[model samples]
Target: MRMPQGKPGRRAAVPPWLRARHPDPVQDDPRICPDQTRGQLGLFPTPPRQFARTHAARISDRTVPGFEAVREELRKMADERQIRARTIWLWRLEGIARLALAARDPDREQVAPQALKDLLYSGPILGQALHRAGLLAPTASHRLVPPRGTGPTRQGGQRDLDLRGQCAHCLAWANDRRVLCAACTSWGYHIRKHGGGEAECNRCRRTLMVSDGMCRMCRIIVAETEVDTARIAMDYGDQLWFARPHAAGLAVGPRTSGTAAARGRFAHKRRLARARAADELQPSEHVLNPAQLELFPAPTRDWSRLNTATPPALTTAAADLVADFFAYMRGRGWNINFFRGSIRTLRILTGHLGADAPIRECDIRALVSTGIHVQGARLINYLRLRGLLEAQPPRDLSVARARRSASTISSPAFAAAVHTFIDVLLGQGSTPSRPRSSKTIENYVATVLDTIETWIAQGLGDPREVTKKHIEDALKPLHGDQARRLHTALRSLFRALKRERLVFRDPARSISLPSNRPVPAGLPSDRVAGLLDRIDDPRERLMVAFVAIYALLPGQLVQLQRTDFDRSKGRLRLRRAGRMDHIVYLDEFTLRLAAAWELHRHHRWPDSSNPHLFVNRNTAVDETGPPISTAAVTLLFQRVGLPAGRLRIDRIVDEAHHSADPLRLIELFGLSTASATGYVLSAHPDRKPGPIAP
Candidate 1:
């Protein structure tokens, strides 16, 4: 044997004379070259070439009996650890097999079953490998044992079992017995000679004592302590117990049963019912804190006092007209605020016209007598629209007609040109196609008319003589949105006119609007809290919170149905514009507030059949009011001096400041990448402001 020169375990380099001449000793033929096996195998007769080939073929074909089983066990373990690659699993298997082979004799050609078993159960590296491979049991309580004589020998005539057999009592491996295992002899099945008892606990099947049909541990749980019983009785009141005020005793006995026990049970149930009723009546702390409570005091006026019934002083005809108007507004989806305003207006209108005056006899003059000119005009228009009053020509009709007939180069002529352009857009002219809808055409024409009127007022009336300077002058005074609209409309009109050869030039083409300016910084945190504190209505407070914290749009907030809120998961599922559902996790405060609001809403509108989470309070016309409109939600925020758009911008900016990642904004707030990037840039103090294209 050769030894290494320096290292303790390193092998020495073999001398050239002693080195094997052939790379593979198995393939070396001693008959062909007598020097190949000069020392050892040369003394024996050389095996035939055919025998060598057959032996090698047999060796290649051999396989372990339970190789597939071992592989499957390893696959399960790999899957448990989220290792999906097949090559990695194969490598692990190869390592485990090599370790198993090297565990005992290194020179052995085959691994012994006894040696493999010992390696598996030795609780070492090999044991862990076997456990991971699912060949060895995970816990001793569920260990398997080999059949009777097939197991390994142990001390005291005992035997160690394989992983296939288990003890009957504890489901663990038994040394020799077929039923009870050696380790489970004491606590599990008791031998007949060792005082085996017949009585056993129904729960754990352990031996029972004289008290009840349970073991000590189970008895301790089923039988309440005196302290526990007394606590329950004292805290909740004397309705839960059946025992007659016994001296603070704590003992296990037969369950009490009698008329008194039955009565006690009934009283306990009644008390629970009363407590639930009281809970419903009390304001929920979860919904509002002390500060919020101080901000929004409870309503003292009786809801029944509202004049939902017919006004006693009004005539039948007048009352009928008022009812019809209310119904009309309700069908149009007008909010509670509108309903209230209309009600107040109606009171003033009815008061102006005496109770005896017929509704048909009333006119705009009657509304004007109330000393509110705007309200009078609105009332007259509404009554006329609803056919409750005689229709009359609008006050501006003569002016509009005169402008259309005028031919001179004046403001009226410009107005007439605008009307003609509007007609062209509405597909009432020589144009071949009407690409814009009536609503869009009206909006475009209105914008163009505004610019034309501005120019005519500046003493420039000839449409042919309109220049880019005039267009720029018209656009300069306007804000970004107004300028953009006017520019687009004028461009469209000029393009149409040029195609028709009506204009020699299209001056609007050179007109451009500046990019939208970033929103102003939001109110300070203390100011925002102060604003929230001023909102007394719970529903309004929740609506503002959604905008102020989550940056939910008005449309999104109004469209929220009861099903969107998941109380158990503390998540709100919002369906965005593209019908994609976005889930937002609620914080502790929001969760509690939501829970309280849900309870309050349920109680306030118990009979309401609307599925919307937020509903209108106009119960007179709509018994079960509809979902709150986006306009109403906007007004709610406006009432507290917070613009919804600015609130959303502030929230996005704050989020950007914290994360400084535009992608996070896009993911959380559903903003476009460009929009998110703009907000992020605006948040940075070092970044210069640049114009983004409108």
Candidate 2:
């Protein structure tokens, strides 16, 4: 559990500070700083004490025994008119003394002194005035005069008296559950349980008295909504409960228009104020307790404990720096693109800005360039929306850089890592949106880790070799599967390693993979024809039949466009269609069916300007070319009675069957690596590792 750091309170200034610093000299241990946490509180006072003697002429009513007689008289008066309960109590207390004194001795007993009682009931000054007139012996005559000092309450040598808050209902806890108690839950007349003398309800008002745990008229009043539920509370009253005023946005009244409403609100405030004053109380800030935590069912996957790696480079400071950069750009009127995907990339690039950085440009390409063709397109779309890409994107650039394309996190490794975490947190597994023939995300993880381990082994021994060439030399010995995996991991590292600026240059620069096939074989030819012929759905039949005839790669088979076959032109124009070179033309039968199906799907002429011919009906976007999803089409063919087969009996996409094509089967499916557009023959496959040429 993380322990929260407490915020420091505000420092008091001037009057408050000075008063807090100094204390009354009269008291013992009168050091100003009372709290240990605050250490020594500095108090300043220039003037020295000028003590003056105080005196009062009148003494307390307790000196005389006429209290009983006074109470009777007041009760008689109360019978006829009005007197407060407190007043009645005072009279009774005085009367008891007076009556008892009379019983002691008639001759020596002085008459019950009204003057002395006056001093006790009223303050010292009133009693003193009467005493000076020679009516009473008031030994304790002087009230502490002129109040010792002058300043704020805390500053002045007077107590910060308990605030007399208005009477309001406050919540209290009972047992383990919430409940209302005597305050709001129960009502009763409260007669003083420990009675000095009996108290009658304020003379002439409904009589109510509190004794023990009971009250008379209190019960009736409690049911009454109008009962004084209002309560007075000190600013920091221990048991006080307060709620914010009902008015919201009222504080933000129009500059001039709502004067009336503001006045009304202020008037209500004034009423509450007046009520407080009547009770000798004031308004104060309300403090509340933190709520207890409630329990929830445990998560499906336990993340509570694991030696989870703390993200090394993705520091909060770096994240903040990136945010500030965006904000700064926004402030400067820069046209900025907003995207969550770029969050990781920007975080990696500048998060550790000026710190030991790991990011460089080449990692950019591996991050952004690889993956489904549409991945880059999606990012481009996002950047364009944010105003990052000002101009339209150009046609496909044959060659891609590993360093320049990373916009998400540096590379596939981060993507894999993030995906791994996401899956673990969700209690599932991660897979790439566009998975390769045999590459699992776990494989990427293993490969990346391997690549990192190799680097660490080679370079950790000597830090100087951590340069780009050193990485290149380390990679030079690698080839085939290891080389690809090594390069892939290196790619991911370089992509995210931008901020570290570890590499002298893009390490994977000038390195390219070879065109190869894991061709399917060992199936009789009849099974292939039978699979295609058994398909009844015209679309599935044509798709499968065409794949069989052309022996195209999965990408080419999926990338087939409506424009590939032109009914008017009577030919299929295949662009770098696959690992094959040469323009492919479909047979009349296949071309006609593809064209007819497209024509049949059109409920009405499609909106002008869409170029895709084999468009997915489900995807509503106006695609550049009408398209069909390869996976969906493959599945559809299987649903339509196609059987398991290899080269001849090949299942198009399912793992159960491996589909393959010969390396030089180009003419059968016209495809050019550079531009599949209206192809011509090439002696070899395009340098860009796409379709191989016949």
Candidate 2 weakest lDDT stretch, 10 residues: 50-59
Q: What is the RMSD, in Å, between candidate 2 and the native fold over all Cα? A: 27.4
lDDT of 2 by residue, 597-643 (tens): 66655543343234554445333222233345556755664675443
- Residue-pair clashes per candidate: 4, 82
TM-score against truth, every candidate: 0.36, 0.28
Regions more than 4 Å wrong, model 1: 1-450, 457-465, 477-506, 519-523, 559-585, 595-613, 619-631, 684-694
User: Clash number for model 2?
Assistant: 82
lDDT of 1 by residue, 566-627 (tens): 88998898886545788877788777667777777766655555677777654212333355
Span of 10 residues, lowest total lDDT, candidate 1: 37-46
Give candidate 2 regions above 4 Å deviation.
1-450, 453-522, 533-536, 577-581, 604-609, 620-666, 671-694
Top-TM-score structure, candidate number? 1
Q: How close is candidate 2 to the true structure, as a TM-score?
A: 0.28
